[model samples]
Target chain A: MKSFNKKEFRHGLKRGLPIAMGYLPVSFTFGLMAVSGGLPIWMAVFISLSNLTSAGQFAGTNLILMGAGFLEITMTTFIINIRYMLMSLSLTQRLDKAMSLPKRMMVAFGVTDEIFSVASMEQGTLTFSFLIGLIIGPLIGWTSGTFLGALICTSLPESLSSAMGIALYAMFIAIIIPPAKKSRPVTIIILLCVGITGILKYLPLFRAISSGFRVIIASILGAGMGAWLFPIDQDVEKNNKQEGVNQCN
Target chain B: MQLERAFLAMILMALVTYIPRVLPIVIFRKEIKSKYIKSFLQYVPFAVLSSLTFPDIFSSTGNLTSAICGTLVALWLSYREKSLVVVAISAIVTVYLTGLFL
Candidate 1:
């Protein structure tokens, strides 16, 4: 019910720019895949508009293409997207405690991996406007990229588009490394995650686990291990303490 | 009929996906009090991002060499505390340029 905060929203938009750019190629590929798989162009675009997810949309659309049943599609999407629960829970820690339920719901819709990473690592309490601003650019990029890909059907050269694949991961690196530099705990946790994930991916014994499950196992083990090995000092964890008192009237 | 089925499937997918994302934030309005749990949540971002990056990032671009090249550039720029756009753009360009050679 409050007036929108233009400044924070602008900052969110600026921060979201890279994420938007990163989504372009991925969503573009999604559009191309869905349409080429025989879904109508509107359907492909609708999926991007409604879903705003990468892996889940891809998996779901793939199932749809194969004429998989609704329950099967639903469950597969859920498993692939279960990681968002951790992300949303983690993000709740950073959000302003006073944020209203509707506002919380709005921001929750935007909790993609890239958005969560950028917002989570952000320096302080996140305002609703800032979160909205952060989400809009990437949302537009994702939908528009889907539209373009579905419409054009691969005009960009393969090399250029394929190179864009690293953009989001690159953005992920940009989010984590700075914090890792300042905190030994952060550095250790990151290495722990990388090592575990690498093993899960490459080990023949664990080869049966899907990539989505690999992320979940690695994240839980890595964070759980960090919590045990390097319990943070309570005082140093006051990043959200000030905002706890700043509830809106 | 197929259109109706696909639409229904998408709606179902959206509902299931939204549930995981929305439930925790809505349910846990009160801040958690446990230190251990708080620490776990705190470390979640780093853990998730790192996990998402490794192995996957190595296979992100055209090939391993280009991906490595892009990853190193991203690491170097971000180590110096470059802005996200700068770091991202630099890495993309790095990958693109590296792709040219291969």
Candidate 2:
């Protein structure tokens, strides 16, 4: 058991290093933004530590600055984060049959896109030790970046800071565009959601829903529509066929 | 202190953030058994990413010119399946240069 734990830890460290490298610049931007928005270093670090969510933290911070109510913050965060539920649900199929409940719970908490991508790609039964490496590795990188960013924001000029802010959006594009290009349905879903959200921001009815509700309603509706149209059975068959080729190899 | 409210706000924000993250894990211990629910989960990422990406692409500079330049650069790079580092650096450089020019 100890040896297994060590192996898993080592594997996780290897997988997480690349992801941490990607996160550093992005989290640095988050930290810089937080400081520029008047947040303290400690608070900025705390946000990175607890939330560990880039988009949600950015949106939440802006809403707070806007003096948005708790309901608004809650709704916005929920909307932004609802994607994790999907990640978690898909991940369960990949977990070890004998995986303990507590470990699964802990692993679920660390389910970001990068982490999910890495973990999902792993072969064999998922273990708590593996999950720990996954969680802690990125956590260290993300928190340190934010902390350093907060400390150095004052020294950096506005132009440079603004440039760094684009990192998060860049990361999002990297994630969405690849899969979208491969699948017409995926592209449609993305365009549909963007169109609906754009309309909501401009339309009076959606304007009344608050930014938080706007995100939530748009996400739920978009996901619901996509699911109704493109069932997962098709994907499963596609994956199975691909898996067969791998097995033959 | 200038930092006090931001600190308080951060703590409140953290607590709010933890609830959403932790609740599903604690409550939904079993796999979601419903097929429809599973299908819904699959599409959420596309929707969320789109919603997040579009507004920022257009509004980051509060000007039409920078937004257009950045979006065009991003679209071109993405269409070619270029590495993210290349796409990001090109877009940022484009925006920064545009800002300097205008």
Candidate 3:
């Protein structure tokens, strides 16, 4: 607290502008989906305000719209969000180890894929001040975009609205393609993950399960298969976490 | 008006999402030295994001053609390392224009 570095804090905020801007269209779509899916405007905004997760919010909102069981919603969201654990854990490595518990708690709340990716890429240890600055812009942007999307979506024409829905997925693809092109491991893993997801989506045997569970099963099994096929040493994690986490994690 | 039900779902979802994000940051106060665990964590983001993107994207826009075209545009731009906003808006434009044809 006493050692607050304004420069790094400003640096974090400056770096965060892109993330905040990127979040607008994606969260806007989330708002559209939540409202169009029959949620109240306040509820849609509440989900974005509280959850701050893209896939988890989408899957959970669908479950809510469908009157899905509580267990189903919980399990689906937990599965969807499990990756953030990894992101936060990896972030711990770059953090200023002496960072206070209160600051740790605050910064952890902002560790989205995009924030973690950018913060991880920063040279040298990360400070709490910089993290707060980084978190503020994207946090404000995500919540506000959700609000904007919720308010704006109701007036849009159907075709335009439907077209805008693809933006999030487009962002998702934008995230993975670059790394998949550069490395053998990333390539194999992306294909494997996508294949498993496809099977869950298309296969008759899995028709009884909901899409949320399917995503859960697909991601877990796919990651497991990827880990088996391409196990990384500690160095891989240490070395690679910083090199690139751009586009969506 | 299932506002109450939606509220319940939101709270549950928030808690579930919150735990995964906070637990690792709070509990792991020290560096994680376990190689197997580190390896698993390393691939989690990629595995999760990739799975979420495919097949799911196809259904998002309600029109397969527009979705595919948008995804292609997005991939091309991101591969070239365009900013996320540029990539997203351009892909959206691709979807919108293709949407017109469809």
Best by TM-score: 1
> Per-residue lDDT for A1-249 in model 2, tens only?
342487788878877765676678778888888888777688888889988877778888887767677677766776667666656766676566566667766777688876775565466657778878878878898999999888888756656556555555665576567667766667788888888888888877667765545556677788788878876675573573244211210
Candidate 3 chain B superposition, TM-score: 0.83
Q: Stretches of candidate 1 above 4 Å error?
A: A1-3, A239-249
Model 3: interface root-mean-square deviation in Å? 2.7
Better of 1 and 2 by TM-score: 1
- Alpha-carbon error at B91 in model 3, in Å? 0.8
iRMSD value for model 1: 3.6
lDDT minimum window of 10 residues, candidate 2 chain B: B1-10
TM-score, every prediction: 0.90, 0.80, 0.86
Clashing pairs in 2: none
**Candidate 2: misplaced stretches above 4 Å?**
A1-19, A36-39, A59-83, A117-130, A234-249, B1-9
Worst 10 residues of 3 chain A by lDDT: A240-249
Q: Can you write out model 1's per-residue Cα lDDT over A143-180, one digit (the tens) per residue?
A: 99999899977556877877888887887888788777
* lDDT minimum window of 10 residues, candidate 3 chain B: B36-45
**Residue A207 shift from truth in candidate 1, angstroms:** 0.7
Tens-place lDDT per residue, model 2, B35-99, is 67776765676677677677656776455687678777877777676655666777778777776
Error of 1 at A9 (Å): 2.7
DockQ of candidate 3 is 0.65
lDDT values, one for every candidate:
0.85, 0.69, 0.77
